[model samples]
Target: MPAFEALQTVPRSGELVDKAFSRAARAGRAKEGIEAQESMLITAANILSDNLENVVTNWPDFDTVDPFYRELADAVCRDTEGVPGVDALRQNLSEVGWASRQIDELRSEYQGRIRRSGPDTARKVRKQAFARFADICDEVEDDLLALGEAREALKTLPDIRADEPAIVVAGYPNVGKSSFVNHVTNARNETASYPFTTTQIRVGHLTRERIRYQLVDTPGLLDQPADERNAIEQQAVSALTHLADAVLFVLDASGDCGYPIGAQLELRDELRERFAGAAAADEDAVPIVTVCNKSDRSRGIEADAYMSVTEDENVSGVLDLVVEAVGHEPELPFDG
Candidate 1:
């Protein structure tokens, strides 16, 4: 699973303000005279600053996030109305961080004034600091709201293990892509919804020679052409460009899947081009192995392999081909 799943809920500005002030009142009641005012100031400042800072810290550093997750986050935000892209998310977090520091500085400055004044004057100084604290919180209210929205959006991402070798199952809808994944993996496919569309991303796993391979079927995102896809789906494809170690392009030659063989070939070509472009920039190429599913129905198409998922024919052979194409070399320990 991606690390974003563990992110804490973002604290709203108003809720944080209320909680800080209420806690400050309790701390003040436990003290006397100028000391009481000082206590209140310290309590409020610490609570607000810590919480605001925590909100900033809780998010994974976008710069250091895995390219797959980072791009996915960017794609998620592009479709989110009123929510800016990844740069904006970084800026908002920076702003909230600045506000938190300002509150801490205000606390130190006000504490000196409270200590130098009489009880009545000290109380007034404390009230003045509270007003500034509230103002600061209000200043970053939108940033806080944006962070909350981002949290809600990102937490919904599928728990994809990035370290494992991933074989992405991609083809047009009803092309037996999901059926192929279901047949190859050990257990039932774990269905997870994509944040951008109602369609789900199904994940299943199989272990070969002590290496676990992840099989993913991205239904709504990769099942269409790049030009025909919306902004959200394009970003999703970009994510896969980073995530996939190999791609299994399934074809339904029978046209029983309702897509023409030419269309399936077109999508396969697009994926090949896309992955080929990515490979040029990296050390290794992500291999795409095309398999014509429902081979029992039709064998007219040219592909790397053939399988009938429904008939359980050559299914394991197709899985073998995918694992071989992935070509993930595991690290060996030093004998020394």
Candidate 2:
């Protein structure tokens, strides 16, 4: 069967079976055995649906409640089991609840007393009384949201397909890195008329003729600061170094501003040296493809001898050069 047909039909068939059982159960089939069997079938169908959704959508199926809740419950049980202070912790929580109620009662009493004394005392006491509770509430809300967002962010990280050819693009600021990505993959990434537009690494898949490659567009590298570096940007660089099958060293042919062309060329040479050393040691070391972009803009900087482009030429020649640089056939199919 065709892949899409298989994807669509299998899930629908499972849902049909689930619906059949559900409709029967809802209608007067209240026998304990029948209802139990139907419930089991429904649960199985839901689990199948969740897995299928994950496959089709290329995302973690977090919308399904059962698995997440089950995992949470299991984790709680594991952490709480055989711990010496488990009972003590529960007791302390109960005591904390009681203490909180008592504090509220005492606060109410103080407020009543202050109200009788004077308006100034009443306002001051009330403010002081609730300040700690308000602070606690704010902290709890912030912590919970932070935890939720952290979990969500963790889920958003891509699951690398085994043996996929991952191509990473790296460059200094205003090097037309994203423009090159868009040119090759037609990715529709956020491109701008200025520099530093790509603040984060944007990953997309390109299937040329049919060969699939994972392309990553990393944020432009700025000179490292003394106090600290952008950890996220560093991670982006690390991803290219470690996970990529090939790295495209994108350079600005225009060299319009910031960072001398000589410096940028030296950076590419250094990268090539490092990559060559790694390739010598490890058979799987990624290759480097040096590409000078923005050929449409006129600048006096000398282009790389191997893959130079004219201002009027399109990106196909550069892409072809990249394919050759990686030692892959330009017409390779996607089946691999």
Candidate 3:
């Protein structure tokens, strides 16, 4: 899933109207009678309005699309021109429709004017309609460009596969959470890397029983409560909260992670609450597997009741626990 930023794929409002009116003018160029001549104007109006409406209709419904992407799309994207929320895209679409209908209404009025007058006067009426159409499209140009900006911002979002199960490793600073992820993925058949827009998070992959799973490691964030984090760090929370099928909440028993055992345990509790909340909303939301790392070193606190790594290089147990939690391991062709 690439960032949703291919706004260049969508035709600009100005360009759409220009092409419609130009084609309309060409089709009506040699017409003689008033009705035939005015019919061309109606045809052009329909083309412009219909094309505009089609573009809006084809856009991502956003409300019913991927939850992973909807989270990113609904936020306010900042640029040189800044506004409030995710409504910019919808707002621009609405304005285009309004302007298109205005053009349609103008065409009807001009058709009447052209029918009652001399040939030259009728030509003037048609010119007035074209000018009004141009003016309306120009007025909504900024809104269209704003939509383009939003699309560009969303384009840089992390390409997480919403279909794959995710194993999110979280804990305090200096915990070997990332190291464990690298160990587990590299130990498997093959490894694939997925980079997030925020540099704090890194993604890895592993395949088991012909099934691929995502392994995520967040370096500096997710150790504290949600409100205490910055905007960028909140992104990590969003991923951990929504996308995680299983979590490995690691605790560095050696106190080398620069946080006390008490703080590490507190963070674990916070993570549980978040997962519980998600579980309430979604029945399939899995629980966290608490892990204590670096048992080889001198330390006081343990990684809690789940599993601890004495080898520091071996994370097979943690991987197995994660596989169990996700409950999606493929059955092999073997007799028990």
Model 1 lDDT per residue over 112-165, tens place = 999899977999999999999999999999999988888888898888888999
- For candidate 2, lDDT tens digit of each residue in 1-336? 111111221223234334533453454244344333333333433343343333334322333323222222122222224332223223333433343354445444544554464534544554444443334333333223322333333333333333556676766766766666766675464331111123445666677656777667655432222123343433334334545567787676566636677777777776666556556667656677766666566445554422323333656776666555556454448796
* Candidate 3 RMSD computed on C-alpha atoms after optimal superposition onto the true structure: 5.2
For each candidate, what TM-score against the reference? 0.97, 0.46, 0.76
**lDDT of prediction 1:** 0.89
Give the higher-TM-score candidate: 1 or 3: 1
Rank candidates, lDDT, best first: 1, 3, 2
**What's the CA error at residue 211 for candidate 3, in Å?**
2.3
lDDT, candidate 3, at 89: 71
lDDT by residue (180-215, candidate 3, tens digit) is 777777554222221223335567888887888988
State the lDDT at 38 in candidate 2.
32
What pairs collide in candidate 3?
none
| Lowest lDDT block of 10, candidate 2 | 1-10
Tell me the spans in candidate 2 whose CA falls farther than 4 Å from its real position: 1-149, 158-162, 187-199, 221-228, 273-280, 296-314, 328-336
TM-score of 2: 0.46
So what's the TM-score on candidate 3?
A: 0.76
